[model samples]
Target: MNPVRKRRFILVSALVVGAATVIGLVLLGLRENINMFYLPSQVNSGEAPRDRSIRAGGMVLEKSWQRDELVSTFVLTDRQGSEFTVRYEGILPDLFREGQGVIVEGAIGADGVLAAREVLAKHDENYMPPELADMHLERPK
Candidate 1:
């Protein structure tokens, strides 16, 4: 092979290899940070990874909430009857209540409990703000 052609081939090969390496590194970084969402049933069935961070959302089970000072524990359940316990060590949101929808983020333990790092309250479409609750709106016929 000619010297110039060999040099050009080497340069192109190096550029391709460098680009691949960079793309691989970026994917690996993202994989670690990605938090996947799962249903209570899925988590209970062991479909979710025990070591990775994940999100599970469902209605807060009635009479399942128990608190101990700064720590709160509750059960989340879906309509299919699958339920899981979650433990969090922070003040819950004001909107949190029994039968309300909530999403918890954290890792699942070997005992099947989710060690939550964050809790988010979810409201339905008909939910009205406290300030607007008392105000009546006139509808156009």
Candidate 2:
């Protein structure tokens, strides 16, 4: 084999290997950071992954909100009535309320309670500002 051709082959092979390594590393990083969304029913049925960050969305169960010092605990219930306990330490959003929609980001502990890092309130499509709630503005047909 010619010297020049051999050198070129080696360079091309190294470039291909380097590209593959970079792509593999990027995919691995994404896998570690990606969080999956699940419903309360899925969590109760053992379908949700444990020990990894994930999102669980449902309605806050009525009369389930409890606050003790900094930590707050509540139950999230899905349409099917399946429920899961969530504990959060940070200040909750003003929209956070019982019987309202909420999505929690956290990890499920072995004891089956979610250690929430963040909580987001989900609102309906027709939701209006609190200041406008008293004003009944009908949608234009």
Candidate 3:
């Protein structure tokens, strides 16, 4: 065929292939992200993603929290009081207190529970503090 026609055909094919390649890579990257955000109950029930990164959220069980001086061993519990003991070797967030909220990101073990690579303790809100939440919650508005 004509050189102009051949060149245009090649350009179109290249653009289509390039777009497909970019979409494929983005989909691959999102595969791990898709398996994210599970509740503690879900985690305990074996619903967490072991092959990818995930976020596990729940209420820190009161009285179930224990910090080991020798190690950073601790337990996190759900709203139902179900507890999952976690072993982390790093400085925990200042907001990581008992009965507070937390959302951990990592992988789940074959034995169950998360083998967390990153732990994020959630507080009441950006403005509200735990003490304030407690005061407001304890006393009626």
Clashing pairs in 2: none
What tens digits encode model 1's per-residue C-alpha lDDT throughout 1-141?
A: 899999999999999999999999998989845644677888888877798788888999989999999899999999688999999999899999898999999998888889999999988889677667556344333
- Clash counts for the predictions, in order: 0, 0, 0
Q: Compose the digit string of candidate 2's lDDT tens values, residues 1-141.
A: 699999999999999999999999998889735644688988999888899988999999989999999899999998687999999999888889998899999999988999999999887788678668655545453
| Residue 48 in model 1: lDDT | 70
As a whole number from 0 to 100, the lDDT of residue 68 in candidate 1 is 96
Q: What C-alpha lDDT, on a 0 to 100 scale, does residue 137 get in candidate 2? A: 40
* TM-scores of all predicted structures: 0.64, 0.64, 0.56
- Each prediction's RMSD to truth: 7.9, 7.5, 7.0
lDDT digits (tens) for residues 1-141 of candidate 3: 799999999999999999999999999999856754677776677666566767777776667655677345456767575557665656778888776888777676665656667778876645777899688879964
Alpha-carbon lDDT, every model: 0.88, 0.89, 0.72
- Looking at candidate 3, the ten consecutive residues that score lowest on lDDT are 65-74
Sliding window of 10 residues with minimal summed lDDT for model 2:
132-141
lDDT of 2: 0.89
Better of 2 and 3 by TM-score: 2
- What ranges in model 3 sit over 4 Å off? 1-36, 51-53, 126-141
